[model samples]
Target: MKKIPETMKALVAYGPGEYKLVTDFPTPDCGPDDIIIKTEGCGICAGDLKCQLGAARFWGDDIQPAYVEPPFIPGHEFLGTVVDKGENVTEYEIGDRLTADQIVPCGECEYCRTGRYWLCEPHNVFGFKNFLNGGMAEYVRYPKTAVLHRVPKGMPLLDALLVEPYGCSKHAVDRAEITNEDFVVISGAGSLGLGMIAYARMKNPAKLVALDILPERLEKAAEFGADVVMNPKGTDVAQKVLEMTGGYGCDVYIEATGHPSSVLQGLKMIRKQGRFIEFSVFAGETSADWSIIGDGKELELRGSQLSPYCFPFVIEHIMNGDLKTAGVVSKTFPLDEWEAAFDCATGKYGDFKIAITF
Candidate 1:
């Protein structure tokens, strides 16, 4: 249809650290199986800058609770088009080009009858609320179980908002099971640790590495494959990965730095039973030495939430050119500046992945 608008530009989140940029906001209602996209590009994550720096797992309590719920409309990575549908939206229509799947499932949990709907259980994390209502905003509403994807059409628009962080880097590199005799690592280079270094270098691992304090994101984590790129500040990144693996350490770490000292530097660079895979989101709480994960090394941690079925496997590796995601969305902003796009998306104003356009 294309003739919808009734109030658009949004940004809400009025609490913890606060935010605001509305310009009439109200514009989302499609329900018969809903659809209504039109967002375009949204990104600004790091869990929306740790729920705007109030993180207690997004502002909760002494035992976790707040999975964000401010004035709503935060942003869940993002991408758009679909302009208006309902009338039983048969798997998307008007103009297509979508991107949903920010959890939302509860389709009668048991993790939605076993497909493990991102571990459903009353979860509903679009921009973190009771249900979908995000994408910084210019209309959003998905509904009918909301698990969209489509997105192909000439990509680029921050590569279709990088299909929501490469579908959370394909579930944190499939829970860090990378092979080729593994050695991995990946701590964090931003933008979901650069899509977990382009899907942990498509499983050819045998070394990979890439820690980051940001030398242009460790030079884009060595052009997204990283054969080694540390900067764990003042070195000793777990004794330089135990002298680059010679003394054994790392065999799949993948934290994605939401920082808590990269979870004690991935519990001192993995290795015993290896396979760490946490995929960060901290803002607090990050101890260490539970005897270095039990008896100075018995690891195998693994946590990675969201992007469950890997949204059509990261939109089929970003529509087949394999996850490079072109120039990692260096920057973009417009929806009324959005506080200078959240001050260049929290990096004060530099270092890629920003998006806000409309």
Candidate 2:
């Protein structure tokens, strides 16, 4: 057995734009119902970047309360190996590989009682709360309330790192309720968007379109599943999509870019009775004409939160080589070089998903 240590290296976020690396941060303790694991890797998400930049959704404003707590270790897309289990923890052994859902739901909440734990009212997510410290460090503690899943012992690092994002992607695609006759357009070809394309392809939609401002990401989108790739920079995306659908527009439009423009673009390019799934963590509030929903398109707009119950399916597909995860994790950095990893994730060097290896 690997001996547990008292102190470990970690990257902690104090506030917006104030993340620091500390070598002597205390290792997390294992409660009677908790288990501790040695982290294998943690992926940097666009939401993490938004949190660092003090986006209104995370930092909050007069209209909304902040969702993030400072001085917390920030990473939810992670995988690890069990190193220690408390006396009351018997479901896992020391050598087991596992991961937990991002959110630690309160089982008594209305949403949790109704089998919708992802929408639990206090919504304490790992990496955002002090008590539920995340896997950006060398070791992490998983509480009993966590929804744990055993990862296959032989799963590749890239496939393992993709579990969280793909779970989220699966949930978002499921919200769209795509059919073989529908023309689906997904905006943003980032990690989440690429995963959405891959999962949506399994439904075999008539046309799968991907939109991004970056040429490199658009190329990667094609490899994943997009039948048509378009750049929104110079193209009239809504017009082109409308023309392709005989003036009706795409049957479903999923906004994953987090940019306000993408939301407006979806409103314009969706058929009158289409479903639009908004899954991005936007930097700020987006302004859209209400008429587009009520009088204009009569659209169905749905918001997708964290991955609900899709982890098992994602792990199974990835392990079976059904979900194409290759080239998605474009880079990996050591925990000490977290700043550089964040830079790559924010597109300084142009990346898909960036991981911090332990």
The residue ranges of model 1 lying beyond 4 angstroms of the native Cα positions read 8-11, 14-46, 53-73, 82-94, 99-162, 167-179, 185-247, 257-262, 265-267, 270-313, 317-358
lDDT of 1 by residue, 1-358 (tens): 4578788878788777777788887798777877888888788877787787678877798897776766788888787888778786675678878888777686887878988887888887888672566888887887888777787788677777878777877788888778888888888787778787888788787788888776888888788788888788868788889887887888888787766888786777677888788877777776766777768788878898877778787777777878887678778888788777777777645466888878
How do the residues 1-358 of candidate 2 rate in per-residue lDDT, one tens digit apiece?
7689999999998988988998999999988999999999999988889988887788788999888887899999888999889899988998999998999888888999999999989899889877888889999999988999999989988889999999999999999999999999999999999999999999999999999999999999999989999999989999999999999999999999989999998999999989999998878778999899989989898999899889999999998877889899999999988988998999756699999998
RMSD (Å) per prediction: 17.8, 1.0
* Clashing residue pairs, backbone N/CA/C < 3 A, model 2: none
Cα distance off (Å), candidate 1, residue 94: 5.7
Deviation of model 1 at 357, angstroms: 20
- Model 2 C-alpha lDDT versus the unseen true structure: 0.91
